[model samples]
Target chain A: MDNLQTEIRQLIIDALDLEDMTAEDIDPAAPLFGDGLGLDSIDALELGVALRKRYQVRLDGDDPSVKRHFHSVNTLVELVRQHSERTA
Target chain B: MDALASGRPRLHRMTHEKPDGVTTRNTTLIESRGLTPPIAPGRMDSFSLPLAAWAAWPTHAPGCAAPTDSPPPPGAVDIAFVDPMLRRRLGPVARMALNVAHRCLGERTGVPMVFASRHGELARTLAMLHDLAAGEEVSPAAFSLSVHNAAAGVFSIARHDTAPATAIAAGDETLGMALVEARARLSEAHPQLLLVCADAPAPELYQDDITTTESAHALALLFDLHQSRRLHVARHASSGTPSNSMMSLPLADLLAGHRPDAAWSGTHARWEWTLDDA
Candidate 1:
């Protein structure tokens, strides 16, 4: 996994209080909602705020595109990378 | 016992060793003059909640009789039994309540629950408020868990309890009101229920204006109306007010064969609780 993907994995665990799991435990390609990691609406919103605070990765929860980026850790990394490139 | 049989009110002084080690004395006046007859048929304003089993965290009050069944589990509850998903989200205070709740209702499904906390999730709420004031977006997870009834909601989800659950916060008299609510709901439709009272002190900013428990603790009681020991609660409008009902201790102290007078007065009515021997 890329450093950014690993960082995103750790962010998800810390922001969601998944204390029992480590960053390595989360599969980058696994779905984060209903099945794979099993997060919910609240966790999604919290992650959005955490990313904005940490990496300045702005995300509008109501935007249809935001839903797609939250599908997996890989998608979140892509979203963060795109944002940083735009800012750079 | 003889003092109450006669029409005499007794004034007893109790010193509470706050978790911070500061001692505060509260003088509880047990006034039973000419009030014994009302209990013969049982007073309308008062109610009897028969308890089946009771458990509390950190059973170390000033006058608590040693627990008979076994010692209470430490501050952190046994999480081996809790779902990993739910266990992670439970704050320390929530864990305190859940630990005792699980103890009283172990493996017993569908039991109705009453969760009472005087300052429910105050710490979380205060943090969110600070974030908002700083022009920062608060964590949605914190907002969701800051509701007064969040403890009950989490417990129901963790246990998959389909039965009724009510969360209560009644200022200083939170425990009394919760017991009253439990009594009204206990009937043939629901013969028994669970009552869990938990509270931690308000954040330091509000602590000066708000009287709070020095430490975080929770108590759980399994109530069955038919039990031989009857809990008699009498409501009286007070002329002079009393201190906050050390919600964590007074009742638990009474049950531990320690004190007999755990009473508190709300605005209109004060509740006097007397646990009678079988």
Candidate 2:
């Protein structure tokens, strides 16, 4: 995994209180919600807040363009990269 | 469930020897006048029900508990027996509350619960406030679980028990109010309900306003409406002296059978609990 993915994975673990998990434990391709890692809506909001604080990127669950990015950790990594590049 | 078998205090002594404050009472007399009005604004409120089971975590005697400010953080209660996924959202008070509630229920399910805490997650709330003050967004997970009823919410979710769950914070009378709520909810259809009371110490910011040493503890009592022996709860006009004691401590003593009767004082009234001989 890239450094961004590792960092985002750590943020997810820290924010969600997934104390027993490590970056490697989370499959980047796995769906973060139902049918995969099994996080709920609360987890999504929590992850959003964590990402906002860490990367200064706001991924609104209500926004159509950003909702797709919440599908997987890889998508979140992509969102953060796109966000950082846009600001740069 | 045998409470003594679970390493709780012996009930044998409770019925045999009277503790300093608790006296053996005739239930018939108290039942006849439960609703008798007091001379003041808040009247007498009393409920008597048989206790099916009782449990408290951190089995340390009340006064012995050190403040949560030391180490292990707010969420670091690794009791080892709890499930990881279910435990993620629980902090110290919720963690201990859920443990004792589970102990009271064991394999039993669907009993509605009324959880009480004097200061529910004050530390967590204070931290969130600090974050917001620094122009940082508070944690969503922390904010969601920081409510007064967070423990009850987590308990029901973890058990997959959709039964009604209520959270209560009534200042000094929190534990007593919860017992009353459980009594009101108990009926023929639901013969039993659980009362779980847990408290962490007040954050230092509010400590100066408090005169008594705050005891950090959690306890759960299972009350059955059908049983003969009763746990008599009574509210009286305040003893006039303010009580800074944590209500759950005396309650733990009452449940452990060390003290058959315990009372806590509030500005308007004083709440009392007594155990009838089984």
Best by TM-score: 2
Instruction: Report the Cα lDDT for residue B246, model 2.
Output: 71
Q: Write the per-residue lDDT of candidate 2 for residues B191-242, one digit (tens) a residue.
A: 8788898877788899776655676678888877656567888877554776
| Per-residue lDDT of model 2, residues A52-77, tens digit only | 87889976556898778998999999
Q: In terms of lDDT, which candidate is strongest?
A: 2
Interface RMSD of 2: 1.1
Taking chain B only, the TM-score of every model is 0.74, 0.78
- Residue B26 displacement (Å), model 2: 15
Worst 10 residues of 1 chain A by lDDT: A58-67
The TM-score measured for candidate 1 stands at 0.78
Model 1 clash pairs are none
